[model samples]
Every structure is written in C-alpha cells, then in structure tokens.
Target chain A: MKTFKLGGVHPPENKLSQSAAIEVLPLPETVTIPLSQHLGVPANPVVKKGDSVKAGQLIAKGEAFISANIHSSVSGTVQKIDDVVDTSGYRKKAIVIKVEGDIWEDGIDLSKDLVKDISLSPQEIVSRVNEKGIVGMGGATFPSHVKLMVPQGKTADVLIINGVECEPYLTSDHRLMLEKAEEMLVGIQIQMKALNVDRAIIGVENNKPDAIDHLMKLIPEYPGISVEPLKVKYPQGGEKQLIKALVNREVPSGKLPIEVGCVVHNVGTSFAVYEAVQKNKPLVERVVTVTGKGVKEPSNFVARIGTPIANLIEAAGGIPENTGKVINGGPMMGKALSDINAPVTKGTSGILLFPQAETSRKPVHNCIRCGRCASICPMGLEPYLLAVLASHKRFDDCETEKVMDCIECGSCLYICPSGRPLLDQIRVGKNETGKMIRLRNR
Target chain B: MNEITLISVISLGSLGTIAAIILYMVAQKFKVIEDPRIDIVADKLPGANCGGCGLAGCRALAEEIVKKESLEGMSCPPGGNEVMGEIAKVLGLEAKEQDPTIAVVRCSGSRENAPPKVKYEGDMTCAFAHNLFAGEGGCPKGCLSYGDCVASCDFDAMYMDHKTGLPVIKDNCVSCGACVKACPRSIIEIRKRGKKDRRIFVSCINVEKGGVARKNCQVACIGCGKCVKECKFDAITLENNLAYIDFNKCTLCRKCPPVCPTNAIHELNFPPRRQRPETKAEPAEA
Candidate 1:
C-alpha cells in the first residue's frame, strides 16, 4: 500500500457512522439553497420569487468559468432569494424554497438501473456534468467540468478517483464506494472518456477493505480501470497528495494536479457524473454522515442539499444535551458551524457534534520552538512561522513562506502540544496572501 | 623590537589607515542630504507610533511631510491638532484644525448584565474567543471581554473593568483607533469628544432581532424604534436590527437614554443624578 511521501498524522479514526447504512432523510419543509454553494464565483439566480420550480430545475446558473449551476433540491415555489448565514458563520445569498412536491425535471432517469454506455461525445459529457452542477464532492466543491476540460496545451495521462475518505468520522465516501460500486465504475469510465484518458486508478484506503475488495472484484468488468489500496493517512485523499500516492508524481507548489499529468475526482463525484450522463440527474442531494462521539445515534443520511443541520441532528437523535459545537465536515478540516439553522450545501460531507466537555479549546501557550508543526504539515510548510507572520500581519513574509499553499488540514493544530492556533492563523494568512497574489497578478 | 616585527607593524598600520580613509570617503559619498526641519517636526509630533496617520512610523511621516512641503493632508490623531500645530510651526506651514476624538466601547453587555448561558473555556483574547464561537452569551455579535482591545491600546487608555467584565475607556484616551481596529467584533468607535467629554451613544452593538437581543443582554438595542420616535433631533436611526446615533447630529441632551426601554442608549461623563421622586430602580439581570 502506498501513501503520500510527506508529513501526515494518524488521528484516532472515530468512524462512528461506519456501520450506519445510508438513510434517505425526509423532505425538509423548507430548503435554503444557497447561490454560493460551490467554490468559485457564486451562481447567478435566474428564478424570481413566487416562481414554482421542479426538483432538478436549474434555478441558479454558473456565471463565471469556474462556477457551477445550482438546482432546487425539491419541487417548490421560490420564497425569496435573500441572505442567510451559512455554516462558516458568514452570510451569503441563498434561495429559500418552500417544498410542495418531489417532482424531478422531465427526462431525468430516476431509476435504479446501471447505465454503462457513454453515448455523448467528450465535449457533450463535460457540458452535461456542468449542467448537472457536479463538483468535486470531496468537500472542495471545485467545478468538475472545469477540471475535466484540460487546458489547451496540457494533457492528463491518468484519472485518479478519490475513494480514500481519510478524514476520521467521515465514511460517506467509503459507504458510497461500497454501495454504488457498479455506478461508480461506470462513472469513472465516463470521466476517463471525458478526459481522453484510457487508464484510471481508483485509490481506496486499506481501512476500507470491503470497498477495496468489492471494487477489485468488479474491475475486470470495467476495462482500463484498476483499484489501488492505500495505507490509511489523513489527507492522502487530497488531490495533490493522492496523485503523489497513486501515480508517484509530485504536483509542484502553487500548481494544479494537471501539472503532474493527473486529475482527481471524488468517488461521489464520479457517481454524480454517472447519474448526470446516464440518469439525467443534476447535483441536488448527497450522502451526509451525521456522527459524533457524543451523539445518541450516529447515522449516515442521503439528504437533500438545502436541509438544515438541525434536521440531520434530529435524525441522528435530537441535539445531544451536552452538544457544544456542530461542524460541517470532519474534525480536522470542518468549519465550526455558527448557526444550526444554516442549510447544507453541495460540499457538506459530515456533520459532527462535539459535547461541551470535548468543546473546551485547549489553552494556548507560546511556541516551544518544537518544530512539530513544520514536521507534520502535509503541505510541507512551516505552520508555526506562518502563524507568527499572520499574527504580525506580515503577509509578505507569509507569501514568501508559501502560506497560501496550506490546505488547512489542521494537521499542525492537531499535533501541536502547545495548543497554538496554527491552522486558524494559517487560514487567515492564506486569505491575506491569496489577496496579495491576486492583486499582484492584476 | 626586532626589525621584522617593526616592518610588519608598519605594513599593518598603513593598511589600517588606507582602509579607514576609504571607508570615510565611501560614507561621505553615500551620505543622504535631508531637510533638518524633518527631525524637528518629528520631535514635535507624538512618538506613540500608533500608525494612525497611515504612515509606517512618525519618522516616516515626518519625511513625507517635509518631502511634500506641506501639512495639507497629514495629521497625527494621537497628538490631535496641537501636535500638528507644533509640526506646522517647525515647517513654516499652516496647521489644519480638527476635532479631538476618543474611542468608545459600544457594548455594555457586562458579566452581571449579560449572563453567559454557555461558558467558553478558550484563550483569553477576543481574537481567539471570536474564532472559537459566538460570545459566551447568546448574542453572536457582543463583546467577548477578552481584553484584545486593551492589549492593542498603545497608550493605557483602555482597561477591562473586572467587576463588569467589560472594557472601560479611560478619560485620557487618544482615540488612536488602534482599539477600534483591534476589536474583532468592531464594537469600538472613534467619536468626537464632546465638550467636557460628555457624550451620548448607543452602548449595544448586537444586531440580533428584538426578542433575541433582549434575551442575550439587558442593554441590547433591540431596534424597537422607541429611540427613533422619542428623539426630537433626528440623530438616531435603526438599521440591521440595531440603532445607531450619528454623533454630529446628537445634541447630548441625554433624552434618548432614559426613553430607551432596554437601557441600550448610554450617556457618558455626566454628573451624578439628583434624586427625583419619579426615578426608579431598573429591573435586575441574571
């Protein structure tokens, strides 16, 4: 088994929802579909208030090249397109829809049959993926269509499917791989065709032996696709790290994975591509794992995009009495959700609730100069120094130190004995440094 | 001494003299010619180096003023108009007059006033506490009382009132705006120091709804429109579920504070009120 040849940490794998089968959550009364769900520019909403829309109907269109379309997860009338605070504690424009029916769009094949044939050309496949609003489902939510459309001169030799759900307490990808093996394989084939690549590797962590075994057994049915089991490591699922782990190629700093002749997509994203190309479904709902040590019943839910976190918590057995914080993803990279009423977006992977006892932030101490943060940073950047620079507002020094390269995996924060808020400062540094880079470019 | 020792000593001495003369020549050749008035002007300005003037330092600002040949667009906030007057005198330039200002902590949600429903066991800094979660109280926008503003104050103008668990602005505040920038919640505002330092402004910055704001703090401005309707001078306006009083229009009549149902409007530097029959003890907070 191969792993990324760099700094990594093995946090306790508290896969609480590992055994919880995916359950389809009941339709929430109201879904707050945010216009800015995906990573790039927020989608421009096309529908007006009081307009009735069907599920899978495009309400928000991707405006920029690096954007994705947003569809109403439920057939509903648009209540209003207004500002609503999200899990990140920031307010953004969202379309509030009142669910009336579960009517999907016409021509969408909402069936259980697996479609293996890829009838559409590569260009058509890329457009369909964009029209379906499929993004990197591995929490980055990068527009998949953009990733598939290789730059004019560059070429991708192989497509690596990310099945390594390396984050502790997140098994949505693992479960997706186990349950939707055939659809995922077909999805990978479709992606390979779109990328004009013949060979593909599905990288699964060895911890998910069942998923690995199932995929391995079915690999012969899908030509030019192979399953590679990886040693369990946090953030090995990262695009750069996974490309390095599977293909033995290092993506240069401040460069895309394509620079190393690879493009990666999450297992769930490949499944979505399969559905969009074959079943004609848009990216509306996904599997969300609501789990925590303090939760009454950790569970996995196939939930609509706009459902509130409170509903998922309710399904996982109402908010625990001792609940202190609810995170939108894994503990290592999840954002501490400020409002429980904030709606789920396309990138929501897991909702973890920490008890009051577990929520006490450790007291911070001056860095002992232990060099542990530098040693454990998966991005191979010095988090301690970056944090100090950020606190001093020395964004220039941070930029020189490549603070923008920090993926904010919280590895340094997790491994720091002094409880220094390394990632918090690095996150701010990345923001400031990114702004400086953009300004410099302009 | 031997002849070889004497010869070696003379050679080393000649080399040392030559090196010294060369260094002197280089130093004189590279010496920068600057206006002597820059140093005098910088000495006249406050050396607090708060960077409130948007320059790197007071010395840098002095160079800029001398280079620009005018004090037209430059001002030192800490030293106010008096220091600018002194600098202008040094530079033979007319000083610009401006109002002296002081920083005001807009939140009055103290420990006794806004009881914490959730205890936050995090670092004792507003920046750290802010990122951890909302304030201990239910209001997400209230002051966390972690003393970040006090820490950022270059001058000892702000202190955490331990009894109230809120930062108190001292009477001698320079209004350098460091605290205003340091506050993560942005609850500090630079306002024109009124005559006798008596000024009136809303004490709460909570933008939560009426019911939600009142639940978190006793002094939260719930945007009930009471202050707006009661004000005869049209100085106060309600926006984003919070009331803001424009100090320029405010007369400091002290009428809005008493009429504010939640005590959100605060009056500062006023004399002790005389006991009146109509005066009453307010409701107690948790």
Candidate 2:
C-alpha cells in the first residue's frame, strides 16, 4: 500500500453510513439555487420572477472562464430571485423556484441507460463538460472545465481518480464507487479522453477493499486503467497526496497537479463527466452522506443541487434532540452550518451532526512547544509558527513561511496537544497572504 | 615609579583637556535650535500616544505644533479642551474648543428585541463573526454581538452586556475612534456629546427593506420616513432603505424617536417629560 511521504494523522473511521444504500431524496417543493456555487465569480441569473423554468434549465450563466453555470434542479415557476443564507452562513443571490412538475430540459437525457459509446471528440467533450457546468464534487468545487484546459507548455501524462474518502465519517465517494463502478470507469474514460491522457489510475484506500475489488474486476474491460490500493490514512484523498501516493510524484508547493504532469478528479466528478459527455446531462445532483453519532439514522441520499439539508435530516431519521452542531462536510474539514435550512451545493459531500458532548471544542490553550503541529502538517510547513505570525498580523512573514500552501486539512489542529487552533489561524494567514501576493503580482 | 606617575598624570590631563575642548566645539557646531515652547506644550498634553490626532505621539505633535505655530487642526482627543486651553495659554495662541464625543452602538438588536434565528459557534470575535454570518439574527448590517469594539478598546471603556448581547461604552471613553476602526460591520458611531449628555440616535443599522428588516428585528428602522418628516431641523435623510440623522444638524428636539413607529431611535440621558407643558397647566390652574 502506498501513501504520501509527508506527515498525516489517523482519525477514527466513523463510517456510520457505509451500509446505507443511496436513496433518492424527494424533490423539495421549493429549491433555492445559489448563483455562486463554484469557487469563482458568481454566475449572472438569466431568469427573473414568474419565468417558467424546467429541470436542468440554465438559470444562471457562468460568463467568466473560471466560473460554473447554475441550473434549476426542478421544473417550477420562478418564485423569486433573492439573496438567501447559504452553507457559509452568508447571504448570496440564489434563484428560488416552487416545483410544479418534473419536466426536464428538451436536450437533457433523463433515462438511466448506460451508454458506453464515446461519440464526442476531445474538443467536443471539453466543450460539453464546460457547458454542463461540471465541478469537482470532491468538495473544492473548482470549475471542472477550467481544470480540463491544460495550460500551454504543459502535458498531462496520467489522470488520477480520487476514491479515498479519508475524512472520518464520509462515505459518499465510497458509495459512489461501489454503486456506480461501471459508470465511474466509463466516466474515467471520458475524463481521460478529455485530458488526452494515455494512462489513468483510481487511488482507493485499502480500508475500502470492496470498492477496490469491484473496480479491479471492472477494469478488464477498460484498457490502460488500474486501481491502486493506498495506505489507509487521513488526507490520502487530497489531490496532491493522492497523486504522490499512486504515481510517486509530488505536486510542488503553490503549483497544481499539472506541475507533475498529472490531473486529478474525484470519482464523483468522473461520473459527472461521463453523464455530461454521453448522456447530455448537466451537473445537478450528487450523493451526500448525512451521518453522525447523534443522528438517528445515518444514511446516504442522492440529493439534488438545491435540496434543503433539513429534508435530508428528516429522511435520515430527524435530527436528534441533543444534536448541537451540524457540519456541511466531514468532521475534519466541514464547516458548521448556522442554519439547517441551508441548501446543499456542488461542494457539500457530507453532513455530520454531533451531540453536545462531542461538540465541545476544547478550550484553546497556549502553545506548549511540543512541536506536534509542525510534525503533523501535511504540507510540511510549520503550523505553529504560522499561527503565531497570523495572529500577530505579520502577513509578510506568513507569506515567507508559505502559509498559502496549506491545504486546511485540519491535521495539525486535530493532533495539537495544547488544543491550539492552527488551522483556524492559518486560514486567516492564507487569506491575508493570498491578498498580499495578489497585490504584489499586480 | 614616582616620576612615571607624575609624567603619566600630566600627559593624561593634557589629553583629557584637549578632548573636552574638541567635544565642546563639535556640540556647539551641531547645536539644534528648537522652540522651548514645544516642551511646555508637550508637558501640558497627555502623554498617551493614542494616535487620535493622526500623529505618532504627543512629543511629535508638540514639534508639529511648534513648527506650524498654529493649532488650527491639533486637538488632543484624550485630553480634550482643557489640555488645549493650557497649551494655548503657554503658547500665547487662541485655542479652538472642540466638543467631546463618544462611541455609541447604533444597533439595538438585543436578545429580547431581535431574537437569534441561528446560533453562531465559531470564533467569538465580532470581526470573525461579521465575515461568517449576519449575527444570529438575520440582520447582516447590524452589530454581530461579538464585542469586537469592546476588545479593541484600549481604555477599558467598553464591555459586552450578557443580557442584551450588546456592547456598552463606558463614560471614560476618550473618543479615540479605536472601536470605530475595529468594528468590521461599522456599527459603532462616534457622535457629538450634547448638552447635559442628552442625545438621540437611531439604534438600527439594518438596511433591508421595511418588510424584510422588520421580519428580522422588531425594532429595525424601516426607513418609513416618519422620522424624516417629523424632524423640524431637516437633520434626517433616507437612503438605501435606511435613515441616518446628522448630529451636526440635529437640534436634539427629541421629536424623531416619538414618531418612530418601531421605536428604533435611542435617547440617552434625557430628563423625564411632564404629562403637560408648564404654560398650559399654569393657565388651566389660573
């Protein structure tokens, strides 16, 4: 089993939803589709009040090269377009639609037939993925179309598919691989075709032998595709870490996976790409894992883009009375949602609820000079020093220490003996340092 | 040994004398002529380097005052008029008196007035909360209740009231504007301290429409323009679905708060009002 060379932690694998088969969540009566779902400039809404929109209709268009288009997830009358509180606890412009029926767009293929024929050319595949507004479903939500366009002077040699749901309680990708193995392989082929790569590898943690076995058995039909079992470790699913695990290549600091002649995509993203290229479907719905110790029933649901998380909780056996915190993703990297009414976005991979006992964040203490944070940082940067510099507003020093390279895996904060919030402080540093770097570049 | 001691003493004496004369000559050549009144003015000014006057320190400000020979724009916020009066007396210059000001929180979204719709569980600092959510209440433009202003106050002049979840400024506040700069949501305003400390200000910063703003907080200013119409001094203006009263133009007639349908205006330190006017009561008795 291969793993990244740098430091990592072994958080307990709380796979409560591993056995829960994916259930299709019923369409919400009203869907609030935020325009700025992806990690770029927000899309401009094309529809206004009283406009009748069908499912998969382009409600907002992504005009910027790095943005993703937002589509309506239900056929409904446009109730209103207004700012609604999203997962980030901030108000953002979103299209609100009251569902009237299940009418999809004229061009979208709603059938679930497995179409394996790759009829689209490489250029056509790229353009279709772009039009479908496909994004990295592994939680970063970077516009998939932008990643497909390999910059000049760079060559993508191999494609790495991330199947490692290394976060403690997440099993969405695990379920995605097992339930849709054939579709994923075909999706990988589509991604490979789009990237113009010869070889592709699916990196799965050894803890998930069933998924690996399933993919391994299905790989015979697909040439030049391999499944590599990785050492079961937290953050093994990180793009850089996964690349280093499978291909023995390290993505240089501040550079992308392309620096090492590779491009990484989530298994979910691969499936989305296949659907977009072969089925003419836009990226709309995804598999979300709602599980925790406090949850009544941990389960996975095939949720639409604008489904209210409250509905998922009700489906998963209503939110427990003692539940004190509701997170948007896995325990290690997810954000605490202020309201359960928040709608799931392209990046929401899991929703974890914790009881009052488990939600008690340890009181922050002074650094004890134990050097645990430095030893456990996956980026090989000193988180202890970064925390100190960021707290002091020394952004220049933070930039010099390479704070922007931090992947925010929460590994350092998790392992710190003194309960220092290294990741929290480093987030501030990264923001300030990124702004300073941008200003300097200009 | 005796002869050597005498000879060394005489040589050292001559060398010391020569070095002392050279040092004196250098000191005289590089002597910096400065106004003696700078030190006197600095002594009269408080030494707190709060930077409220936009200068480095009191000593630096003294030098600027002595150089400019004018106190047109140099008012020590911490020491206020008394210190400036003393400085002016020493410099033989007419000192301009400026009114004292203090920071007042413009939002009244207390726990009772504006109930929290959601709970904030992250960093308890107002700045972090301002970026994270619109407070627990749906008012994105109001106080975050995290007391960032309280934390930024170097004078220990602000504190968070647990019952109300709002910051209360102490009387010792020097009007230094530290809290103003510290607030991420710009909820704290430094307004002119009125006669007998009586002042009025709208206590809501929610810029949402009347319906939306009222939906979030019971006392949110709806910008209904009732206060604007009632203000006889033409001190109020409505913009962006929010009403702002100019303190400079406001005569403190105490009319706007009574006309505010939502009771969004706050009155501070005003005497109690009688049921009827004294003239009318006297005439009725007669």
Question: What is the lDDT, from 0 to 100, of the residue A200 in candidate 1?
Answer: 97
Q: What is the Cα-based lDDT of residue A80 in candidate 1?
A: 90
What TM-score does the predicted chain A of each candidate obtain versus native chain A? Answer: 0.98, 0.99
The residue pairs found clashing in candidate 2 are none
Best by TM-score: 2
How well is each residue in A1-442 modelled by candidate 1, as lDDT tens digits?
Answer: 7999889999999998888888999999999999988899999999999999999999999979999999999998999988676776655689999999799889999889988888999999999999999998989999999999999899999999999999999999988988889999999999999999999999988988888899999999999999999998988988898998999998899899999889899999999999999999999999999999888889989999999999999999999888888889999888777679989899999999998888867778889999988988888899999989987779999988999788888899899999987877777677768878999999
Local distance difference test values of all predictions, in order: 0.88, 0.87
For candidate 1, list the clashing residue pairs, or say none. Answer: none
- Segments in model 2 whose C-alpha atoms lie over 4 Å from true places: A364-366, A432-442, B1-16, B28-45, B55-75, B81-98, B117-122, B275-286
- What tens digits encode model 1's per-residue C-alpha lDDT throughout B1-286? 9999999999999999999999999999999877888888888878989998888889999999999989887878888898998888877889878778889989888887798865655345677667666777756788888898998888898899998888999987888889998888899999989878989999988876676678768778878777798889999999988899998999988777777777777888899667523423244222
Among the numbered candidates, top DockQ falls to 2
Each model's DockQ score: 0.22, 0.35
